[model samples]
Target: MRYLSVLLLSLLPLLAQAVEVGERLAPWTLLDQFDQAYSLDDQTRTLLVARGMDGAKLVKEALQDRPKGYLEARHTVFVADIQRMPALIAKMFAIPAMRDYNYRVLLDRDARVATRYAGAEDKVLWLQLDNGRLVAQQEYATAAALREALEKAPH
Candidate 1:
């Protein structure tokens, strides 16, 4: 019983992670490094939410180059697949400082599924971004796809 209790306690926080695929997640609830809240409404122009480190890295690199009409300045959100093998992911996070790079780790229990959302394995993904009044929607092949699209979008 004691062992079961300890195990349950350890797993409780993991189970409580709020990220969900295809489910509408509020911008306000997403926690940043300091545990502060950022909402979609807070984004003045573009909001980039990538599922994996590669995607975020590429997008950040592209942003650094300052693509035309698409201001490099934007809200960047990163979601990590936390439920997978711990060592592999731990190394991934350790090598690159996610927080220092202006990226926020997404709290998702299903890392594999979240990877799919980040457009991992070359599969296309549908991203739903709610911009206060009008709903902005787009499909992305990879991180660059949506970044390019948002750069050209009127709103």
Candidate 2:
């Protein structure tokens, strides 16, 4: 019983940051891959948050065909959560890639923002928000499914 209690207590902080459906996302400010400032306020009418590397890769793969202008025109924001990476590695590879990358990739450095949306790692969290209020969320098992959903979603 004592061990269970301790375990539960240890998870309390994680539980506190969970983002629920139908709730407005908590305000967040993070850096883009280029190390530029990107905030929740800077997001679009529809936001797609990828929780970890797998999620980011999925999101990238799903949107492979779309050009930067198309994404910008659609008012869609793609956030890449890189909080799981070591600080040194992030500084080395992750941050530097942004300099040449065309698309915007928001780097959730501490992952606090990502944890607020999804506690798990390596899964994409598709969140559609309007004026900062969450309207929908779903987990995709395949890139094709995610692509179809994004194609069908209201822009």
Candidate 3:
């Protein structure tokens, strides 16, 4: 029992260090607004995470005028954590509204994936990855700034 306890204690630090740069992110799959499953893989170059409604609005505004495949062309994925929203609201309004979006919105229903990365609640967290390994991270609080960054990012 003592050995087991010691082993578990040692693993705590590893669990706490979620989504760190210079490390590979564990692969995950989540359903999008259209109920299509998307998975993190080597081809995913950028991950845009929004933990709250404001952050999600930033992403929405940034992509409002863009074409349907804009993010996909850049090998980018946008994840929105909707776990805090009430189930009734999500089903009756949120998810339904999301279906009209031009770009894909990966829904983090339980926040399991979004919680792994650390960032401000109102800012969009941008994770730059190379073949599944984290290379850089940035946070955008403005839709214009996020739009500019996305435009400047390589395809």
Could you say which candidate leads in lDDT?
A: 3
Per residue, candidate 2 scores C-alpha lDDT tens digits across 1-155 of 99999999998766675666678887878777766787786356666777777877777778777766555666776777777789898788767865555578877777667667763455677777777888777777667887888778665
Top-TM-score candidate index:
3
TM-score of each: 0.44, 0.80, 0.89
- How big is the RMSD of model 3? 5.2
RMSD of 1: 7.7
Ordered by TM-score, highest first, the candidates read: 3, 2, 1
Off by over 4 Å in 1: 1-28, 39-47, 65-81, 85-96, 103-136, 142-144, 153-155
Ranking 1 against 3 by lDDT, winner: 3
Error of 1 at 93 (Å): 4.1
lDDT accuracy of residue 63 in candidate 1: 51
Give the range of the ten consecutive residues with the poorest summed lDDT in model 3.
Answer: 11-20
The CA-based lDDT of model 2 is what? 0.72
Ranking 2 against 3 by TM-score, winner = 3
Candidate number that wins on lDDT, 1 or 2? 2
List candidate 2 stretches off by more than 4 Å. Answer: 1-10, 98-100
Error of 1 at 77 (Å): 4.5
Model 2 scores worst on lDDT over the 10 consecutive residues at 114-123
- Clashing residue pairs, backbone N/CA/C < 3 A, model 3: none
